[model samples]
Target: MDTPQNTALMRALAEVPGPLPTSGVVHISLPHTERFTVVGNHLAQNAALSTTAVGFAVRIQSLPQGTEVGIKALAARFPEGEKLIAAALRELEAHGYLHRTRVRLPNGRMVTRTVFCNHPEALLRPRPADASKRGPALVAAPVSTQAPAPVTAPVSAQAPALVAAPVAPHVPAPASVPAHVPAPAPVTPHAPLPAPEALETPAPPPVTDRPVPAGPLPPAPPAPRLVPPPTAPKAPPRPLPQPRELTPGLQQTAVALLSDLRRHAPELVLSEADIERLAPATATWLERDAHPDTIRQALTTDLPQPVKYPAKFVRHRLTVLLPPPLPGTEELAPARPRTVVIPLQTCEGCERAFRSRTPSLCRDCRTACEQPAA
Candidate 1:
């Protein structure tokens, strides 16, 4: 059976003189089941929103929760540049279809959190209008000409019962008193105060030679416990025993090596004062038959990043990792040679020096001597 509203709509449509115009849009909307978003017509047909903003808003709303809808992400996904996408986002924000806020994460990183609203009309509160200018008055004034019949109806209905009820004995009726009598004037009396001998004064505190302190002065704080000012951290103990008067030549070699350290590791660059100060330690390494390369390796390799105090670091390595002196002859035993070297001899035939195990003529002279006389 057709409902009255639907029937009326059909009749109204039938009364139209001609067929529907073919120029406008026609929707072929189908029931959505799986992956679809419902968008409100207020946003879809909004006159103030630009085409790009409308499309971007729809895309944002359809996206799954936590999906990236930032300007760069959208720009990467679509051909529209970041500028256009950002403008579209701004438009969406202005119209209340989207909100983007920079939020700081718990780990101290900043991120943009976006919120999309499908129905901006419901989500975004419209500015409240001035009551005096736009809204109708909530309270209407009562008309003076109209009688108060509704308010007086209940009282009028109970009038017979009220008139028949017996009045209480304590209750006074309006007509019981004489109308001409005047009321008595109010009376106030003042009482006499007590004699002066009844009042007593408080005694004053006793005087003492020394002034008293509040709460015993906290036991004089135990003379501050004499903390000794923390010993000043002891200044790192300067390289100890100071290399025992190194030679001028040895000192120069050490200084040259120290200055050249920058060639291998740029971070190990040393000032002139630093090089002069560390020269004795470097000379000590050389005195112990430690090669300049070995010193360089020790200082440059495995260096801490940024080497804030390069001179101090070099001093520590030099003092702590100094190699033991080479062994004495008594400590080392001689060993046999692996191979013998041929002695150089002059050839009898050509008088040219050549190496041979046995001193004799050269190969050419030997062959000539062995041949028959010719």
Candidate 2:
């Protein structure tokens, strides 16, 4: 009869050997009785029987009497190999699922003897009711049985004892009288004294008339002299000089000199014609003297201004030298103002013109040009 346990064991074994099937059972006739079994093929030669009830029985029968199954042998038989089988065995031992016994081999070295429980369910089940919990248990005693004694005492015993005792009454004696008692004498009723006489007042003496001496009153203090404060010294007024207009020639010359100085030495000042004429000498003198104010004063007084007008003379000279345009020619061609308009690119960052194509000032000036005029 094939039981469920036998069937499962056979199936596991059959997986190891192809020849063994679920329905196939090998009957091995031992010398004593016929044992029904499964004969696994060569693959089963290395198959391991688990450390279970069925596995134990199978293992016993599978190995020869002298055969010793160690970790290596079990590993060869285990599906996952020896290392995994050894690990599983350790785990089972830790979980109380298996027990191990150490046996001494003939080599004098210790080996393991593993045993498996037939009923794993029983090992995993809850403990019996009679078994105590793992740790200590606390039991509380009854409070009424161990109560303390009362502290109160009987009232009559605690009270003090009182006895009857009599006290004598207090009596005060009367004060004694003096032996010699003298009575006070009676007061006499004397007669009234006479009233005091009135004092007499003397009359005042007669008045005498005496004339008071007269003296002339001194003249009233002389009237204050009204003396006015001294007038401030009067300033001398001078006659005004006639005004004169600058000659056009002088004006033109000044303008020309200013323009020339601006072109050569922009820092020079043209305060007066004399100063302008003496500018170069004054600048030279200042360089030698190291005193610019002294040069300035000398230049202002030393240079002479032109006496005659030059613009009138220049115009007359030009008119005589150059021919006048024809009457129709003048109408045909009116003079156009000649102004040199430098290209923006020619402008140096300075207001002056630059001859080079790549002006140093153009880029800087570009930013200024881009700004809105204030």
**C-alpha lDDT score of every prediction, in listed order:** 0.73, 0.43
Q: What is the C-alpha lDDT profile of model 1 across 153-256, one tens digit per residue?
A: 12345343522323325855576557687665653223332232333244344444557876754432222221112223456665532566699989999999
TM-scores of all candidate predictions against the true structure: 0.29, 0.16
The candidate maximizing TM-score is: 1
List the candidate 2 regions with Cα displacement exceeding 4 Å.
1-69, 103-108, 120-374
Top lDDT hit: 1
The 10 consecutive residues of candidate 1 with the worst lDDT sum are: 222-231
Give the per-residue lDDT of model 2 (tens digit) for 149-204.
32232334533254122233666754864668555465332432212121212333
The TM-score that candidate 1 achieves is 0.29
